[model samples]
Target chain A: MIALDYSQFLTFEPQHHWRIGIAIYLFLGGLGASMGFIAALYKHIFKKDDPSMFAWSTLLGVLLVNFGGIFLILDMFVWESFLHGHITEIFKVLLAFFGAAVFNGNFHPWIQWGANFIALFSLFGTLWALSQADKAAILNKLGFLVKIANLLKPLQSVWGWGTIIFGLAVAAYTGFLLSVAPAIPAWSHPLLPVLFVISALSTATAWYMLWTYFAKGKDEETQKVREHVGHQVEWADIALIGLEILAIGAYFNYLYYAYAGGKYVFHQMLSDMGFVIGFLLVGLLIPWILEFIAAKKHIRILVPLAAILVLFGGFLLRYYILHYGIYTYPWPS
Target chain B: MQEQQNKQLPNWVFVIDLNTCVGCNACMAACAQENQTPYWNEKWRTKVEQAEVGKGDNIGRIFFPRLCMHCQNTPCYYACPTGATYKTPEGVVMVNQDLCIGCEACVTACPYDARYRYDYEDVEHNKQLFGEEFSIHQLPHIDKCTFCYHRITKGLEPACVSTCPTDCRMWGDLNDPNDPVAEIVRSGRAKPLAVHLGTDPKVFYVGLDTLPAPAKEEAE
Candidate 1:
């Protein structure tokens, strides 16, 4: 019998709404948020007043998030306002993104929620960075910045706590944004948020470790402290990378073995050789093994390569999930 | 609450007969002209999809006219960040281009792939092709099939429906008991695509299956 079948295999066009641009934003945003949160946790756990690590993490978070925001602006087509000589176009976009998410009773449309979280994370992260500037003596040459940092020093804890809350929200929200999109089979999963959080933590940890390895501190004691930090973060990345591997494996099994929706997503993933070779093997498993060996043998030389691979793997993971995010086609009756 | 409001207004539905669709492309032309859609760029508000069937001597084609499902449970509506994609009381899913930020979330969320970007560039291309004969869209935003909303509300059939030479497309109000198109839907003579998706689409298809489905009574 002749049938007008709406076959899933006949997907002629993949979803191009989100591309590499979005992948970069999600990556940077997740990285920034995780760095900010992890730094706060480190301070609380270590009970240290030394501000270099805290200041650096928060400062990097503010910068990365703002940089990611530029990609969003590039993606938006608000040329109507621009053509009309309205520079407040971005303000309108921001207000709409933030206001709707904040005021809406149902709290719908995950993008707005994501934007709100990112904004809060950036704001508190900046303030936290400023507060630490005076103590860290990194921004001591900028007298007014130091003065402002000192004046706001009383609210330092508030900024730190806000950074943790909002930063974590931003990280998790990036995954949540894709989770709610049911049409895209690859992204619409409960496991996505878990996977993203793990990636965020690991990538951020690897980044800070790299910072310690590279950044030159003047004092002998500061150099020792940074070395200690680099060692500590290497340990954290080992655990975090392990978590990421498990999360990704679970994600694979969930989609590759579940119902048609799950199968549909993995079908696309499996077809793309890059998903396994680029993302799984080179991006994830290789790095995981390297980091494991490095930590076990106390091979400090191997940490940087593993760290860089982890960061690359994190981006590749998101890249595959998004780029291969084929939409579920309708079935003909 | 939307369903409650739909009680007073028309719950518009389309019952499209695939068997009768000759693939004339009249509906496409009419739709493009009526809506000023980006037809030049092959971005259609409504277009017939073709699939070949049978081997050799008995070769035939299925002409499936595709458009926005205007689902009762709209994924596009749920996905809109600024509520730019909204459903009218009369069951028409519409996009408020003014509120649209061109984020393309709704485009990705649509299972039907019905939505497309009708940006300033597309408008500029329209000018190059059609000149100033068309009044440009005020703001660049996502565009999709609106079911000829302007005509339907004024006690007129949708442009495509009215222009269909084969009478393949039928429009009616589901709220009215005597509505013929609604009766076609009620009788199980027609059914919507992707029933499993739970989109609850208002548009229904007829005569696409040559073998006929399990008569909607196999379970019973």
Candidate 2:
């Protein structure tokens, strides 16, 4: 038998820097924005006759992008400088350093730059679309803004496609952020990005389903639109959930066959019943099954429950991944 | 003389004589004092790790003094988003406090677990060590052993090396063929920790043979 060195095994607790707040922000923000962008794209590509769906998706996408941005800013340590009256100086330094690092092609800075650009584009695009619809009285009164909105009318497809690409990038970037941490063997995998993208899309579909269900109108024409959108979202979510399960299985299998460090992480993750049972079984598996059943039976109530469960599972997935990341003990050689 | 030229060489490396190490932890204390690290935080730039080998009567204890290996391809350096952690021209890995965002990416990337986040409590000590404006700017930056960059650049030995009672620690240039550390390494006895990891660690253990061999894989 291999003699395990039980002696002198030192494992330190990681400081709570990137905690639940940041995880939630990354998950919800990425999912909401991406789902909204995808919905808008679908509207442009297939349902160009009904531009109202595009308007609703754009509004939700902009709100989510801005909401996620608030949390992100709060998570930064640089924000604390505001209390000491050095916020300006600190921000200037941060911008200068991060700007230079982004230019140099560092992974983290590039992720930050990409996320910011996507959020800004989504926000501006949504507002521009809303303004052109004459929904906002403030925007409608501005003559110059009206002309710019008219000018952008020709590039609606380009704008829609741009948001889709950026939204997908935003979803994947969260995984890349975690995978870059060399200490966390469980997270430092190629499959993590793939897994995150699938999860994000799954959650996005869930959110859209809930939104369409709640926003359903009493009129026959409006009801038809809601039912049609709902049907498409349900099918997409079922596919995304299937892909998520497959990716997760592959991820665990990879870890099990990996080196000693990877095996240790895999074992740790398996042993945590809260994660395995609560997050994986109750959250993901149950929801997936419900969605499948609901689609077949055409159960409207089951759809919302399944959607909520998926959203919960998405949050828990991120929580467990971040919180349970155990740094392998540096064993004596 | 060749010895005189070797003494002035760059590319400093640490030679740790494991056979002579008594695990006194004097180096740990000296490092903490020299760096002005807070007492509450258990984060250490250098410390002694002890493990026992063999069964019952044959059991013997081995002491390993741990510190930053100052790797050639440092994971922390590559992991830093803002290039806050960098390698000096003299081959010393140091954190540029002004640039560090306290994201703790370097702290997580370090294989040896050498880097630590300087929290709000350590602010006063950091200000005293690095000055007011620099400390204010670098409030929560990651910190680790810089191979005593301030002392080494000023032609003084590191506190840990100087304060070690057993004289197990040796700091000198690895580039110089005549340097004692270079000679010990060339003699085919010295070995770096985790050589298989490809970190190319500068710190070498001269009497690693005295310690127990790594555990072998168990039979199914």
Predicted structure with the largest lDDT when compared to the true one: 1
Note the Cα lDDT for every prediction shown.
0.79, 0.71
Candidate 2 lDDT by residue in tens digits, A45-87: 6663224455556666667766765555555556655655667
Q: Give me candidate 2's interface root-mean-square deviation.
A: 6.2
Candidate 1 lDDT, tens digit per residue, A87-198? 6765776566556667765367778888778878888888887887876755867889899899878998888889989989999987987775666667888799999999
Q: DockQ, per-model, please?
A: 0.37, 0.29
TM-score of model 1 vs. true structure = 0.90
Write model 2 residue lDDT over B159-196, tens digit each, in one string. 99999998899887777878876788777777887665
Quality of candidate 1 docking, DockQ = 0.37
| Chain A TM per prediction | 0.89, 0.83
What is the fraction of true interface contacts found in candidate 2? 0.22
The structural similarity of chain B in model 1 to the true chain B, as TM-score, is 0.89
Least lDDT summed over 10 consecutive residues: which range in candidate 2 chain A?
A1-10
lDDT of 1: 0.79
